[model samples]
Target: MSFSGWGYVWTAVMPLAVLLYYFFRKKYKDQHVASTMFWQELMKEIKASPYLKKLQHHILLYLQLAALLICVFALLGPHLTSEALEGNEFIFVVDTSATMLAGEPAAFELQQELMKEMATQTGGKPVTIVTTGANPEIVLRKEPNREALETAIDRLAVTYENAKIEQTILFAETLIDDESTVIHVFTDALDRSILANKAGMAYEIHGIDQPLQNVSMRQFGLAKTEDGIRAIVQLVNETAEPVSGKVILTDGEVEKTANIQLEAEEELLVPFEQLPDSPVWQAVLQVKDDYTADNSMAAFVQEASTRVAVDSSLHELVGAGFRSLNVEVDLMDPMQLRKAGGSPLVTNQTDLLAGQMPILLIGRNDEKTHRVAGAIETVPHALFTYAPFDGIYISEIYPPFEEYETIATIDGEPLIQLSPEGDIAVLTDIQLTDWPLHPSFPLFLWSAIGELSGTDNFFGFFQPNEQRAVALASTRGEWEIYKDGEFFYSYIEGQGAFSAPQEPGIYEVVGEGKTLKMIVQLSNEEKTLVQGTSYRIGQAEETAETAELSIVPWLLFAVVFLLLVEWEVYRRGNAHR
Candidate 1:
C-alpha cells in the first residue's frame, strides 16, 4: 500500500485527540424524578445489562472517530503497487497488419486485451499507444486518463498494410527521454531488429505466440485463347511442411475442382482451359489454415473489345492481328463508320476525310512518285511494350505539325503520329512501303488500338496515390462514390476525378448510367503471415516493476457500512429510552 498524498496523514492525529477528549468528559443532568428509589432500581437494571448499555452510549463516539479516520485516509489518496514506476512513463507499440488477423483470438485482439490489462495496472503514469499500420499513428499520447487509454485500445483495428515496425519503434524512441522508461510492443514475431538498434533501452515484446500455416493464392490471371479464355491460379504453401488442398474454381454457375499437393515452400500454378464468357472468376482453396484472409481470390478476364472499322480493301492480315490480340473488330467500309475512343478507323478510303474526329490518313499507292526515307520513333509510349519499331517507309509525304507525337516516321515524314489532342494516329500506305512485312507489324497495330481505346487506361487499383484524374465520357450533373456496395459520398460530376480513400478495399464511382470500379490493396509484405516469430530486440538489465491494485476503495466502502450500523444502533437505543 502506498499513499499518493502522504503529507495529509498527520492530520488524523487531530481527530484522534478530539475523540479521546470527548470520551474522558463527564455527563450530568439535573432532573426531578417521582422517586429516587425508582431511579436507583433503573440504574441497577442497566448495570445488570452492562454490555448492551455501554454499546448504546459509545456508538456515536465510535462512528465519529471512524468517519474522521476515513476522511484523513481519503485525503491521503492511498494505493497499492508491487513495483515502482521509476521513470513514470510507458509506451505501447501495437501492430495493425493483415497478419494480425490470424490465430484463434487473432493477434490484434490479444494485443488489445494486453493493453486493457496494462491500463488497469497503471498507477496514474503517462502512457502512449502507437499503431504500426501502413501509415503509422499514435492513437493515445502522454496522458494519465485511464479511461481514454482503454477507449483507444478498444478502437484499435487491423489494416491490410504491413507492420511498419521499425519506423514505429524509431518514433517511440523519440518520445522517450528517460532511460528508465519502458516500451512495450504488442505484435507478431516477424520483425524485431528495431529493438536492437537502441543500445540500452528498456523494452519488452508481448507477442500473440501462435502459428497459422496458410495456403495463399499469390496470383490469378486469365489469357484469351483461340477457343475461349484460359484461367491460371498460383498457389503457395507458406509453411515448413508439405500441404494438401482442394481448389474449387467457379465461373458463373459452373464449378470445377482440382486436388493439389504442395511440398514445403512450394508454389504451384493451376490452369483451367476453355472457360466461358464469364467476366469474373473465383478460386477458393479448401484447406484448414490458421489464417483465412488469402484463402480465396478473384480474377477478371476482360478481353479487349475494340471496335475497329476497316475498309473493304484492308488486308486480311490486319483483321487477323486484331483477333490474335483479343480485339473485337467490326469489318465495315470506313466511309460508313463514326470515330470514337473505342472505335479506331483503319482505311485508305479518301471519302472518309470530312469527319470531325482525327483521321488516320493513309497515303495513296504511288511507288514511282515517292521514295522510302529513314524514320524516327517516339520515346516513352505505351504501344512500345509488345513491339520494336525498326523503321517504316512512306511513298507520299503529309503535312507534319509540332503538336503531334510521331509514333513512326516514313522517309523523313510522319508515318504514324499521335495528335497533341490525343485522339489521332496517322500512318502511310502499307502497300507502297515494305512495313507490312516487318515482324512487329501485327504487334504494333495491336498496341496502337489499345492506346486509342479508353478501356486500356482504366486504373486497376488506387494505391500509393491519393488523387487521380479520370476522363469521363460525359460529365453530367451528379456523381457519387460507393464503398463495399454501400453509398459513401458524393462528388461534383464536372470534377472528372476522385481522391483515393484512406482505407483499403474496393470503391466504385457510379452515376450517369455508367459505373467504374477501383481497388485499393495494402502492401504485400504485410499480407504474408509468418507466425511464431515474436521476440524483443533490446533487453535491459533492470527488472521492471509489476503493478499491484490498491484496496483503498474497498476500505472506504467498509467505513460507510460501519457508519450505517452505528446510526441504526443509536436510533434503536433512543427509542427504547
Candidate 2:
C-alpha cells in the first residue's frame, strides 16, 4: 500500500506527549483538621521516591492513548492493496486519419478490436472515447457498461483529413478529474515526444507495426491543345519497393491507357495526348497497393475561352498583358462594343455596359487628379498574392464605391475594388499613376483576367476537409452538393462557405443556375506511409498482485469515533469520583 501523505507520519509521535503527562501526573485533595500530620508523613514518603512515577491502569489514561494512536494512524494516510487494475476511469484516444486505413486488415480495424478488448478488461470501469481529425470529437463519454463500449467501438470510422493527434490528446486530458484515470491512445502517426511532455499523465500508446505500401496521384490537370485537350498525370510511389502500374484516362466516353514503371520512392509525370472533348476527365491507377483512397482522381477540364475583349483607351497595354500569357486578345472600339454586346469586356467608361459578362474598368475618363502620400493598405485577397502595391506612386484617385469590395485603400479611400458580379474596377487611371512603370502592372492585369473570367474562384482543386467561400453568380437559393454522381448534402443560401468532404473524391456544387466541380485530395503529409513513434508514458509502477485503494477516509472515521469514546470514558470516571 502507498501513502500519499507520508510527510504527515511524523505526527505519530504526538501520542508520546500524552504518555509523559500520564506518567508524571500529580493528585491533590482538601482534607479535615486531623489530616496535617498524616499529610506530612505522605509528603516525606513521596520526596524519597523518583520525580517520574509509573503508569497506572486507569481507563482515562488508556482511552486517551488509544484516541491518540487512531489520530496518528489517520495522519499517516494508509491505503489498501488489492489485485486488480489501478484506475476506476479509462479514456481512449483513437486516430481516424487516412493513414490508419492502410494494411491488409486495416490499422483502424485493428485499433477497434484492441480497444474493445481493453475496455472489456476494465471490468465495468467508466470509459470515454475521443477521435482525432481536422476537428477532434468525443464520440463516447464516461460510459461504464461493456456493451456500450463495444457499440461505440464498432461504430468508429476513419477520415481522410489530416490527423491532429497531439491536439486531441491534450483535449482529452482536460476531462480527467483525478490521478486514478488512465488514458489509452491508439494511432499510427503519434510522436512519442508529445506524450513525454505530459509529465505526470498516465497513458499508453498503441501503434500499428504492420508494413504499408501505397502509390498516390500527386497531381492531375488538363490543358487545351491545338488538336485536342491534353491530360497531365503525376504519380508518386510512397513505398520502398518499385512499382508498375497502368494509368487509365477517361473522358466519360473515350479511354486512354498508358503503362509505366517507377523506382522506389520515385515520382513520375505521364502525359496523354489527343483526348476527345469532354467537360470532366478522370484518371485511375490500376496497381496493387494497400491504400486505395488516392488511386483515382478527377478534374474539370477548362473550356477553350482564354480570350479577352478590350475596349479601353489603353487597349494596347491590356492586349500586351494577355498576349504575354499566351492568351488571345480582341481589340474593339468603345462605341462598337456598346452596340455589339460582347462578353468579358474591358472598358474605362463609368456608364453601365450592355453585356452581362464580367468587365474590368480601368478608371474614369475625368481629368481631375488627387495627390496621395502614406502607406498603402491592401485587403487579403487572391489578387494580392502575386501583385502587391509596394514601391508604386499614385497621383490621382477616385471616390470609393460603396457597393464594391475594396481591395486596396490609401488614407481610407478605395483605389482597387471588385464587385459581387466578378467585375474589377481600378479607381485610378494608369497614366495618372506611376504603377504602370512597376512590374506589378502586368501581374495585376493577369490576375484581373483570371478573376473576371471565373478561372480563379469558380471551380478548382481543394484539400480534404478544407473550407472555402462559395463564389457564385447568385446567392439566393439552396445549393446541392454531390459526390461521385450521388447527392451528398444541401447547402443553404447566404451560408457563404462550405467545407469539403473528409474523403478524397470529386464533388459538384450546383446552385443559382451554375454547376461548379471541385476535386479533393489528401495532403502531402498524409500521402507518405511512414510509421510514427509510439510508447507508453506516465505509467504507474504497479505490481502483478497489487492495486492501491486510498483508505484515509476510513482511518479518519476511526479517529473521530475513538475521540468520542475517550471523552465519554473521562466524563463517566469524573462523575463517579
* Best lDDT among the predictions, by candidate number: 2
Instruction: Provide the TM-score for each candidate, comma-separated.
Output: 0.64, 0.58
Give the per-residue lDDT digits (tens) of candidate 2, residues 1-577. Answer: 6666779888877888867766677776575546788879877876776443334447666667776787777677777755554466778988888888888798899889988877756656688999987678898999987789999999988877888788888899898976778888898766676766788668888887667888988778887789888889999987899999899998668889999899998999999988887768889999989988778888777532577888746636667777886777778887766653434677777664325767888876543557777667897665765677997888778765678888788867888888877688888777767776777777777767767765542466677777755433343557788876799888764464667777787678877676777777787677667675556677544313344556777777776787788888788888998
**Candidate 2: TM-score?**
0.58
Residue-level lDDT tens digits of model 1 in 1-577: 7778888878988786986677556667785667989889878986798556655667677787777788788788777776544345789988877777787888788888878877877667788888885456888888677788888899888765667788888888888866667888888764565554677777777876566787787777787789887888888888889989888888649898889999988989988888776665677788877877667666556533356766556777667766776767677654466643436666654444445543444543222234545655654454554455665544565454467677666555665666654544454556555656776677777656655543432334554224554433333555677875898777663354456665555566777676766555544565477655545545444444666566777768878897898889888988999
Clashing pairs in 1: 189-533, 189-534, 373-411
Give every collision pair in model 2: none
Worst lDDT window (10 residues) for model 1? 361-370
Q: Residue 20 deviation, candidate 2, in Å?
A: 63
Winner by TM-score: 1
